[model samples]
Target: MLPFSGNASPLPRNAGVALILALAAIVTASGLLLWLQARALHRGTSAYAALETEHLRVAAAETARAALYVLAADPDLSVDHPGEDWAQPLERDWPGGIHAWARVEDAAAYVDLNNLACSNQPGRPFSAILRNAFTACGHFEADAPVDALADYVDADTTGDYEAAFYRHADAPLLPPDRELWAPAELLHVHGFSPALFAPPAPAPDARHHRDELFGGDFRQATVLLPDAPDAPVPVNLNTATREALLAVAGIEHAATVRSAMSLRALHPFQSTTLLAAASPDLASTLEGAIDVKSAYYRVRATAEHDGRRRSILAYARRDPDGTVHLLQWLEGVS
Candidate 1:
């Protein structure tokens, strides 16, 4: 006989087990739902953050453009409105709680590309002093990778500097006709020092850095001159600060500078070839130092293009009027 005290209700036991299983399933499902909801919320927050960053960047960029327009409209903004410093905040309280501020800058205060002597002038005095410094700075350092760079770029090859560059490098050099669009290309040139070719580093305390001393402005720095448009303010040849002259890489010749000056003194050099013939001493001291035309201007602008933050970098001259132009602009954004 079955246990005398046992209740014969099999359905009761089955129901109890079923209820326990159902409770466990409900708990697991709730946990999964909570996890999915949390994940979705995280994703939404990240997307919102990115969108906000983009909005901030656009606002900052617009501020820069507006300031440039203002300056372009006023020929004497720099002198007359000295307090319109772009570094200051551009604050505003707007509807919908959207506010933006920006900073603006001029690039001429730093090293000017206008003064360097690496252009293709025919015969010009090498700046003994400057060359010595440059050489000491590793240009001619023994065993440097680019020791041959100057000789190659300066050589009067049937091909331009590009052809000479690849020819001088060891076999497997870039194809012979390849062009160098950036100064960093010098690293590939023969006789260049490893130091020169090595990437630049941020200062010990600085949090930023760049690969090239210059990004890609060398191409824009050259000038053909008599052909170059008369700038809003002419690049004073006689008084063209060394920075302005260095911008083209052609003005290194004392003769080129003097001749350019004399032409301005006599009138701007009307023809590129005549620039050299103007002053024998300057012409002889320099090679490829003078040109009758110029197409670019040296410009620098710093702004808060990221909206809430400001970023700054040197800009090569894009045009003479100091309007919106292009140059190497670096952002902290990676």
Candidate 2:
């Protein structure tokens, strides 16, 4: 009481404790606000990235379409040969670290699987050709695969697998009995495996390279469906591989097929007349089976942006009136 000073008492213990608690609450609120802001920013960035990736994909697809239009407008649409503008790969670099590329392939050069079974006949010539082609590709029991596929698409009840066969299976599935919408649908057929139809591994030596040089490799042959189910699909002589020619003409006509390959290499056939003049025997044999032009083309487009990638596969069908239409489009390849 004698030491009373002008200054008031320092403070109550409870008051000091309350002040400390208030400071702690303010620190916690600041930290939580900062965390919420960071989360919002992260989500916004992610959404923008996804949008950019999709835009890049669409741009790549349009580039491929424009290239196809250019090809359709060419006056020499009668023949699809190497070194043509359409045959060359298209590549483009855009702003913001984006890149795109595309390539065109002749769909008519490949054997049409739809042509084989659409007739509803199991033992058609196309089926035999498919069997032979698969055999040459190193598949064992090739006939089983061909027969199973024929049964899958043929309308007739007479097939390798009948209704009774599917009834006892675990999945209890029946044949589609219709044209195949896509080549990959073959995997659903019995005796057809991915390993058998996959692209062949690269050759290890010069001898293997030489063997593949003349299209002896079965993997070079593509499996495509015809654009028009009712019309007969013809092979493009200008683009058909030697293996395809052999499959169509039979092994007995090997010499004539080799001759045709040589002639086409020198000068791609401009028309069926040119092909006939080059190899009369083979031409006459493949009259209705071959053509010098391709109405169907496959286009593959790929795009890359900001460490993201997208790709699409499209089929372009050119009409007789010179109008090109997109037959199919498959996206998100890789």
Candidate 3:
């Protein structure tokens, strides 16, 4: 019996099946080639990015070294002010689509967060500053933050906001009960949140606002310095924001802060004596919480090559002899 009844032919049916298999093979080969090409392209892009990042890192380091030189060349070691060349921003472009930007900031111009851990004092004077800062920046239980921070940093285990409180969070963490290493670490402490530290919206018109006091929103105005235990970091009179000046013990009056800032604007206070002599009302406030010189500075730099970007953050100290020493250097910082 012939398998093909009527006019059916086995040859045509076999040819059709072969044709379908050949088409399937072609489609599979094409898909495989496409995937391989895509993977190669991704690899090339990743390689280029890594190389660009390395180059940018070197560029950022060099820029920071140059900034240190600029800081060291200041003639007046007795004073540090924004009028100096080191305070200016740096922007430059190289021939190979490479661009760099750097800014030098005075660390003394900010409120130091580590001041909350005054281990020796019966009453932490800087606690008032942090509380005031919280009130100014957010609408939370102001005292809660200060007290919680104290618990986090204080050498004590018995507090309402101690390690036990943090243990109940979704991702439990243990508080070191030590000074904060950076400003961002506050997010880990109780009574602190991202909302409290987020910066305000940028101006649509691209305008620079000069009236901000330090720690207003906590993002740009606060710092964590490894200051001596139980000691409050003094705010620099020449460069500190009005908020920083207000946080000082005796400098509470707004009018007095304004008056001193006005005097500072006219001429940088060459000495605390000069400030006191100019205004007796401010003399007492300047006794300990303020100074005319800045010992600490931060160098922030960003480099861009083609479409890739990298950043570096650094902290440095400047001596009275016009020598600058790098304390910490962080790469790939935002």
Candidate 4:
């Protein structure tokens, strides 16, 4: 085994070990460099996402303001219908490839929920409208949500669907006992579910369409006029759907509603007198509850860039003089 004679062997045994160590060091350094590059890329993406959110927010806000201005520019505020210019949706293409869209809907086209809160009595005229809506939709015990919402909105604790009913669930809950901050808060009340508020699926037939009018499209048939519990928003005769019109008045004579719809389709009703001439009985029933114009409008605005999007829901009041005042602004609406 001592074939090597001099102090130096053919080669040092440590040389092989040194080579392995050098290769390992190089590999480790390469791995570290790759990791740093990946981390930098991740940070960059995050930063870009944040910036995009800000840009979208600004664009969405701009869209909302532009929509309100469009509403303000309407030449005639005496009457508003879907055919009006302001009722048309607005869209714009910004310089930076960002796109925005906005639209306004007659808020009075639906039953106003805050009106129920204002009365807190289910059988009153306004509450009856909500009840009739549920009935039209074929909801059993049509008064259930009406009463439940009463408990949720009233300050007093003396209601059948009040706070106590929510306490025994797997997760106990308590109502705020105040006006709702938003329509979505209805989910927190007893006897209300997410399914109830979801958009109605399209129906293929006439019979199914009638049933979906209020029952399945409950969310579309009702609204919560922001911070307006005491002042009632009248149903716009020029814009209210047949279901909504029947809710305010009664469907005992659906023929009456059909006649009104038929007449309005031919030409928009200019005043309550026109409705009175059509049917004195219907006019009487809808007296203070109806208007040829809408004061409240719901505005939705959205912006998108690079497949990312942002949105806002705006509630506003339009005065007869074409003035627009924003009542509420909700961000993060899809």
Could you tell me every candidate's TM-score relative to the true structure? Answer: 0.48, 0.83, 0.77, 0.85
Better of 1 and 2 by lDDT: 2
Q: Estimate candidate 1's alpha-carbon lDDT, on a 0 to 1 scale.
A: 0.39
Arrange candidates by TM-score, descending. 4, 2, 3, 1
Q: For this target, which candidate reaches the highest TM-score against the unseen true structure?
A: 4
CA shift of 174, model 1, Å: 1.6
Q: RMSD to the native, candidate 1?
A: 10.1
lDDT of 3 by residue, 108-171 (tens): 9977777667664333366766666654444337788878888888767878888789899888
Tens digits of per-residue lDDT, candidate 4, 1-334, equal: 5435587665456776798899999999999999999999999999988888888988999988998898899887887877888889999877579999999989998878777656533323676777777766656576777888877877788888877888886778897777776867887776778766666556767665445334436665678887654556678988887778778767585677777788888888888787677676666667667888988998999999888899999999887788899899989936
lDDT of 2 by residue, 205-305 (tens): 76656343332565565466535455556678778877677666666666767777888889887777765665666555565567788778888888887
Top candidate (lDDT): 4
RMSD of each: 10.1, 4.5, 5.2, 3.7
Better of 2 and 3 by TM-score: 2
Model 1 lDDT per residue over 1-334, tens place: 4323456644566677798899999999999999999999999999987666665455445555555454445443222212333324445433324454444433322122223224432343333322332433323343333223333433234333446456564664643222234455555555433554343344455664321222212222222111111211123232333333443233334345444545555554344446445544444533443333222322222233323443332233334454545454444431
Please give the lDDT score at residue 177 for candidate 1.
25
Q: Give lDDT: candidate 1, residue 186.
A: 50
